[model samples]
Target: MTVCAYLALGSNMGDRAEQLRQAIHKLNRRDGIRVIRISPVYETEPVGFVDQEAFLNMVIAVESDLAPEKLLETALAVEQELGRVRTVRWGPRTIDIDLLLYGDKMLQLEHLTIPHPSMTERAFVLVPLRDVWEGGALPVLNRPVDEYLRLLPQENKGVQKWGTIGWETGFDHSES
Candidate 1:
């Protein structure tokens, strides 16, 4: 059975756009995963480890036959392939692929969490999430995601729309 899942992708190192594009294509090429839709890219200020370059962030919707844990593994594999070095908390990365939601499944595991805990708190996440999700509400949040977005303080409001990604022409990795 196929499950609909949401993934948040962000890159702060190398060619950020290309990194994100590459990650998306890699995920799309995986056997059990098919990229469904992508949110517009956003330029966001660095979060916890704030001394690094700003990040390009966005979300993607996917139809996947992989279970949630395996899906998270795939995402981590993509990050490793992209040369992501996890040295600091919320630090810079070549690419970061976070599994935001997996169908309506609520999961709590040592290495993964669904409805990614920080989704609503960060505008970088909510802005693009609102773009891809059909409605303003999310499965886990009782109130609309917009409500959380509005309450985020200005210090954390460093998110702004950048542009959309093209899936067919430039970054095609269909046969990979």
Candidate 2:
């Protein structure tokens, strides 16, 4: 069965924008996964660990036949291939791929969670997500993502559009 899923991508280490683009490219190349649309990239301040560099963030809508766990494994492998090292919680990284939603299926497993637990509270996640979000209520929130976006506190103004991904010349990843 094919399922539509939203994945949030972020990077704060070593050519952040290029890292994100490469990650997206790798995801699209994966079997049974096709990237439908990508949100405008956003630059945001680090949340949990403020001692790091700013992060480049974006969301991608994908259609995949891979099950949730398989999809998660794909994401993890992509991250590892991109040089992601998990040293700290919410720490800086070369790339971060989060499975935000998986076609209305709510799940809680040891290695994965659908609709990412902290997504609703983070503007970095919600803002870019709102960009690619099609018309429908988020499965876990049970309300439109925009509604949840509005309910969040306004203090986190860190999320702002960086630019369109493929159109931007600064994201040339071929040399790396």
Candidate 3:
């Protein structure tokens, strides 16, 4: 069976935009995973650890035959391949890929959590999430993503649209 999954991608180190594009391309090349739609990239301030550079963030929708766990594994692999280092919690990194939602299934395990625990609170996640979700109710939240986005505190939700991704704007491969 195929499941629709929403993934959140971000980067703050090195070439942020290019890292995102590469990650997406890698995912698209993976078996059982097909890129469907992608949200516009957003430049956002750091969350937990505010000392790092701003992050370029976006969300993607994919149709995949892989189970949630397998999908998470693929995401982690892509992060590692992109040279992500987890030296600090929420610290700067080359790439960060999170499995935000998986076909309305609620899951909690030792290493992963569906509906990403902090998704509701972070603008970096919610802003791009709303872009692809378009006010659709999330499985875990049972409320439209935009509703959650609106509930966030204005002062701290430092999300700003950076620009369109190459795929979204039909840019040449060389430009991406």
Candidate 4:
């Protein structure tokens, strides 16, 4: 079985851009997983924990044979590999990988949730996510990316496309 998964990547500690790249690389390298499309990296002001440096964030689209639970475990492993520390909620981190959507499947387990609970509310997640889906639509929300972005609170956090990372840098996600 193939699942169209959406993941949101963000980093606020160390080389933020590099951390994001590493997280994605690790995801791609996992068995039974392939990255389909990656949105351009975007820089945004920190949300919630207001006094930290801005974060470099992006969304990745992947097709995987792994089940949702296994995928969540894979994401956590990648976070650990990238030096992520969970000292505080919404705290600084070397990397953060959130499974935003799982093939239109709604999940609620002890440690994971599909169609990520807060995705619609976060501008950082929504903008880049829309970029990855070829048609710029969110399958889980059934809403256009443009519309979802507009509904976010009126904050001036800006997001812009940075570039791509090399395959050898971290994990590998093959593109078809």
Per-residue accuracy of model 4 over 103-155 as CA lDDT, tens digit each: 87988888887878888888888878877777656775678978878877687
**Residue-wise lDDT of candidate 1 within 25-135, one digit each (tens)?**
889899899888888899988988889999999999999999999999999999999999999999989999999999888888998878898787889998888888875
- Superposed on all Cα atoms, the candidates' RMSDs to the truth, in angstroms, are 2.0, 3.6, 3.0, 3.2
**lDDT (tens digit, per residue) of candidate 3 on 29-123:** 88888888899999988888899999999999888999999999999999999999999999999999999999888899998888788889888
User: What TM-score does prediction 3 earn?
Assistant: 0.93
TM-score, prediction 1: 0.93
Arranged by lDDT, best first: 3, 1, 2, 4
Count of backbone collisions within predicted model 3: 0
Candidate 2 Cα RMSD after full superposition onto the native fold (Å): 3.6
- TM-score of every prediction relative to native: 0.93, 0.91, 0.93, 0.89
Cα deviation of 38 in candidate 2 (Å)? Answer: 0.4
- Candidate 1's C-alpha runs over 4 A off are 168-176
- Ten residues in a row with the worst lDDT in model 3? 167-176
For model 1 the local lDDT of residue 46 reads 93
> Which portions of model 3 miss their true places by more than 4 Å?
169-176
How would you encode candidate 2's per-residue C-alpha lDDT over 64-167 as one tens digit per residue?
99999999999999999999999999899999999999998999999788879889898999888888888767776779878877888887756888887683
Candidates 2 and 4 compared by lDDT, better number: 2
